[model samples]
Target: MNISISSDPQTIAENCADVIWAEDKTSRMLGITRDSVGPGTAAVSMIVGDEMVNGLDMAHGGLMFTLADVAFALACNTRNSIAVGNFCSVQFLRPASRGDRLTATAKESLLDGRNGIYDVTITDQSGRRIVEFRGHSKIVPGTHLAAASGDPAAAEV
Candidate 1:
């Protein structure tokens, strides 16, 4: 969990996204991409691949969940604190198929002390809702990045 973060909020958010993409091999293999990251929001996308299809000839639930989870992780970690998901629930509305590009957008709904709630919406390229995910997170005591070299002010986000 030793990652390089930035003092700037936006840079910290971007660094979190980069760290996620670097650390999560499952997300990388699934073709997940971090589209954007902000203070309390993140967007991730992936194209449904043939290998990701399930027995039903549709995108597997696990893949969709991973995409949403990545977005949730990026959104929650923007504060430069190590945020771990405590609970999450996903509701599948429509099945996705190979060649479909899916996007998951996560927005923080509430944050109190170390606890937070995020809502993620997964949609197809056409903007059709595919899944809904709600994630609960808890911020831990450590910072994601160490202080930058020669810059005392670049401590944490």
Candidate 2:
């Protein structure tokens, strides 16, 4: 809720989209799509696929973690506040099968200037939680420093 500039929600979402779109398998395999971003809420959805499953035929922990991370990113980056994950921990509760649609919802728990915390949940098509993640992100000013440099590989933070 602390953006330096006031703008339409769509503009904020679009700017975040550019970052997500550039992600590789972590985003693609999880089927991550930004739903919306409001003052302090961010939603993202994903679908489980064969490529996202482990040998046990359930969604891989990494896939769930990625989806949760995406939600955390969007939630903490509200108002054009670029955020980077300082630390994240994911707990796997259940498992999801292939073809199951997954959605990760993240909401800001607290924000203190440049530091924010988020709680994210990953659920299956049936709305059963498969994983829960707690992420700590740091907000900073300006556009994504990596994208601004034009070298995405060097932007890994």
Candidate 3:
């Protein structure tokens, strides 16, 4: 999906998210859908399928983490800068079973220069929190998309 976005940060951010959703094959394979993306925030959702269940019939912890991670990645990248995950931790609060639709919401907690901190909460459709995640991001020197296109916006950051 080709998207033409203006040089503004918010537009760049939204375009970056579009690129992620279009290019990230792993996210596609997991059936993750981006519900929303804005500056410093993102929400993503996925349904627990039989393939995601463990022997105990509960959703695997890794899949839950991945859901939260995707939200975190989208939130942090919204600055129009290329931000990569430096560290992340997750705590499982409840077990999710097959057919449960899980949503992960990420919010930026802090941003200091090139470093940023984000918190993500994963919840079931009923709004019960299932997992908590914290992610640290490091902003790199280039924009994810504009840099590739030789746009001046990439150099502004």
Candidate 4:
């Protein structure tokens, strides 16, 4: 969270994306590209695929939820080291098919001391909202997975 740059969301997002995309295999597999990350917002997008579908040929709920979760994490940790997402609530409003492009956006709704709140939304290429989510995250003092390992810089984002 020690951002060296000014309060530019797009810039912060690009920098964070570079680090995250390079290290996270889950993000790579999901094709989750960072669209933007600012003071209180994070945006990411991906294309729907067969592997992500449910029995009805729609994208799986878990994938949708994961996408939103990533957005929330990104938004919550924009300028500081933070642990987030003790709980999340997701509601699917529509279904998405293969080849459809989806974007998930998370915006900070509240931040109080070590706790944070975010509102997330998932949409298709046509700008159709497919799902809505809200999450709560906690900002801890130190790194969780990265510092735990010998290399404190493992998760540089």
Candidate 5:
């Protein structure tokens, strides 16, 4: 993919996230915000809405999973490479109600070649644990800046 890549670690991560965020319609639609991004780390926040509630009046499992997945995606792709989730598992701890603000923080656990593992923990505004998630990622054949204005150049890690 032809695109200009940043050299600075924080700038690269933020730039990569900018490219992703511009195309992440699902996250925008769900009111998810990219709270912070850095090399191998990301934090995304969202609020539980009535639409995301389950029959029991608690936040649906899928909603929380989506939040974690957003953070996981940002973390894995910060290295200037396009990455996709290979597998993921989430454990719901405390149920959240509508109006609760949750933040999912993803941190790199292990990185070996094109494969990586990330751990994501979701917490409510009060710092109560809500979910624990693990994601495996596989680097793909592209760069996050592929859609940016530029000719194709290799985005180095």
Candidate 6:
């Protein structure tokens, strides 16, 4: 809302990501960090904790899915538009243990109208692939920045 970033598409995307990350309590709670963002791309990282593991002593599948989902959501919403995930699927390739740091990177593979497809790869600190996630996102009826500038009428779909 402050318009601190320039009008360049890349800058706008990064700035929009800042706005989104600031209020993403779920990511913050999971110890996730927004590493970098650009047009149609984003990377987030998190560490596995004791509570994040299942009885098998491995990281929960949901935890990895959520990491990839966060990256996908940020990648699609970089154009000032708000996007929500409609569907997603994850393939677990390996296991992760406690204290392991994992990074999820998202790249937009297709964007048609209000629908977009993203591919997210989750890797361990050693760069070994852990999960492959695909997400479908749908643009919603709102702007991330302009609508929050004290003008209620600016929030048109």
Ranking by lDDT: 5, 3, 6, 1, 4, 2
Give a tens-digit lDDT track for model 2, residues 116-152: 8899988887889888899998876665322334544
Task: Point out the higher-scoring one by TM-score: 1 or 5.
Answer: 5
Using lDDT as the yardstick, the better of models 1 and 5 is 5
Quick one: best lDDT, which candidate? 5
How well does model 3 score by local distance difference test?
0.90
lDDT of every model, 2 decimals: 0.88, 0.72, 0.90, 0.77, 0.90, 0.89
Off by over 4 Å in 4: 1-19, 143-157
> lDDT at 116 for candidate 2?
85
RMSD of each: 2.2, 7.3, 2.3, 5.9, 2.9, 3.5
lDDT of 4 by residue, 1-157 (tens): 2324333456655555455446668988788888877777889999988799999898998998989988888888775454557888999998988998999999989988888889999999999999999999988776322222444344453
Q: Choose the strongest candidate by TM-score.
A: 5
Worst 10 residues of 1 by lDDT: 148-157
Better of 3 and 6 by lDDT: 3
Candidate 2 global Cα RMSD = 7.3
75 in model 3: Cα distance from truth in Å? 0.6
Model 4 clash pairs are 1-79, 1-80, 85-137
- Expressed as tens digits, the lDDT of each residue in 56-104 for candidate 3 is 9999999999999999999999876779999999999999999999999
* TM-score for each candidate, following the candidate numbering: 0.89, 0.76, 0.90, 0.80, 0.91, 0.89
Off by over 4 Å in 6: 1-5, 147-157
